[model samples]
Target: MRNLRQKQASLVHRPIAWHVTHWSHDVYSQGAYSTLLPGGSPAHRAALGDCLDGRLVIAGEACNPKAPAMVHGAWDDGIRAANLAVRAGARRVIVIGAGCAGLGAARHLSAQGIDCVVLEARERIGGRTHSLQLGPVTVDVGAAWLQQFGDNAVAREAERLGVRLVGTDFSQPLAAASDGPVDGIEAAWEALRRGIDRRLPLTEGVARYLAGLAPAEARATRYAIEGNLIIEACLPLAELSVDSLDEEGVGNDDHFLPGGYRQVIDHLAAGLDIRLGQPVARIDWQGSDVRVNDALGDFCICTVPLGVLKTLQFVPELPQPQRDALAHLGMGRLEKVVLQFDRRWWPRSPTGYLRWYDTPASWVEWLDLTDAVGTPTVAGLIAADAVERQFSGRSDEEIALAARDALQAWACAVEAVR
Candidate 1:
């Protein structure tokens, strides 16, 4: 048999700087985003956010059905929760988990002449929308992209906040792997997916759509599936629901925050009462007023991520539907490893994604952030089982090495084609 060493041959060029995230291991997030199970329903998200006892509500990306697992969704849900609190005659409100949702809720509640305070377990605000300074530039380590930017609320917010954004064009074709000559692929892919059997997983749906694709088209379709869909879902396709394929965000433009996404977080957090380093241990909500830790409020909005919510203690336990919502959904891991070399070494691509389809492990997808972040940097994205293996205690330098090896493999493949 051919030696498996060929599968992950290492490159000699060492990176000067590196950053990797283990959102799953994070005590705050637990995982990067909410995972849509094979046969999950948006109703479950509704159930999760359902207001209880007219004094408690859950708010987060997981609570927004139209746009779950999105930063704007969390922010929007927080605002929605704040409105609900106002309508319910809440005098004072306590918002849990100072993420986009919490900050958004606090901002809205404070504006509405209501007394509100936000409790955060982390030392800083922004939560999942985090940024880190690397060399001379600031890049987002948490939620980075302003997806579907044209109508994205965060995109508009970025503009008002003066945060710089660089557009991503994935179809530039220089760095991406095979799966060529598939015209109308996006519309075609969506059309075929519209009637996917609901009982089965997304893998089955993809299989049905790819039943008799041409050799070239099949390759490209698989690349798109593995590089785009799988990466977005943050789970192996088999674990995703066919329904996930049915939904698409309204717009198409995806932009990176050149100055980092924290600009939005900082803007929303301004003029709000937020308490940091206060982890909520239990919520006692059986009385007329809800009690979260030592803070009590006429109403409470819990914006905790779904992964953390599963283990959080609630007094009298959540209703059956909410508990069932927690049981039905799952959290999928998506992490990034940033590798900055002394100089640009790999083949250049238009500012977008470089997907190496030859091997779908480690760095299956890479975002060329050189132009976006103004440094010789590339962000390698890994998901699903890759997350488990990396976070099991792998160091950032080791992850950088593995990512560099994948870049070597991609370079070799590109040379062969030329």
Candidate 2:
């Protein structure tokens, strides 16, 4: 036992406490967010949001073409679904999947004197936007950043709730305790992508681009692409489209709600009729009235994630457009690991990002939350193949060990280089 303990200690240092998100394995979520496949277009997203038979509407982040995979988009689409349901003469609504979208729909419908019943699979209402009190400070295990702050309703709600929104300048990442290089590689990517057929899956296109390069240069560029672009897409390059690069880009500044992002979801859910631990086994939309389990309503707005929606049983089936959209659109995996130390083990300044380009690249980029939460915490994200390869089937302790080892190895490499 003593030798085993010593071996473990030598392998890696441990944090006081840690949390990891197994989103892909979650039956309710099945994925972190939505993404377009090789042939899917933005119109597919619009199609997914379309009202079915004027009595049923599918609304969620995946449905919002303007900003799919965003909290504001999910919230906005939920409100949109509610308005459409009212227009269709719905006085009572059954909102499925008590996520941001369901909460948004319920909030809108209830305000308009429409009776709304929200059924959530999980005990929590936030869905993938859950918040947890890790150690001394709160950490968002799901969605954290308030993107496109200027037009984001989520951000606006945060401010109204008196939550502090801290601006993050991602351009100034603290790498090795110094401002890292900010060479926007769009120019290089364009040169590589210039003549390649855009319809090819991102991997094929990337392969063709890298094929001509020398071995070392190709490896370095590939590493950058994996760390930056692949991480952004949250899916394997083979499943992702070349358009992902353009589709994933967000304009305007993103703010971090250090006060906890769950506040916005809670505010949206306040005073609403939400039933937790009630998963809709089936949604029968065969007639004018849609039935969700024991509850039946004139209209049902399903905000269940695309990942879950694919597995959900809908009687008589959804429309061709919705079915087609679901077929073409894909869900992307994004998993997070939050490590809280007894004290700050990293820098407090820059407070944005710390990236490591080492081999394996499992926990390559991390968000420094030490400054935001006033606690010594760092969150690292792994997506796509990294999630499946390194994290799947691994125990939480083992995953935590992997991350600590990666960080330890990175620090040692930096010191050796110095």
The TM-scores of all predictions, comma-separated, are: 0.90, 0.91
Clashes of each: 2, 0
For candidate 2, lDDT tens digit of each residue in 1-418?
3543344346545699999889988999989889998778889999988988888889999998888888888999999999999899898899998888888899889989999999999988898898999888889999888887888887888888888888877655544311222233434455555645676677787878788877655655666576656777788778886767666433358888886778788888889999999987688988778889899889999999988899988898888888999987888888889988877654444545766665455776788788788877888888788887788678998898788766655454344334
TM-score of 1: 0.90
Cα lDDT tens digits, model 1, 174-288, are 5534322233445444545564565656687678767767665565666666555666677788787766664453236778888888778888788888999999868888889
Q: Per-residue error at 252 for model 2, in Å?
A: 3.9
Q: How many collisions between residues are there in candidate 2?
A: 0
Worst ten-residue run, lDDT, model 1? Answer: 176-185
Candidate No. with top lDDT:
2
lDDT (CA) per prediction: 0.77, 0.79
Q: After superposition, how far is residue 314 of candidate 1 from its true place, in Å?
A: 1.1
Please report how far candidate 2 places residue 60 from its true position, in Å: 0.6
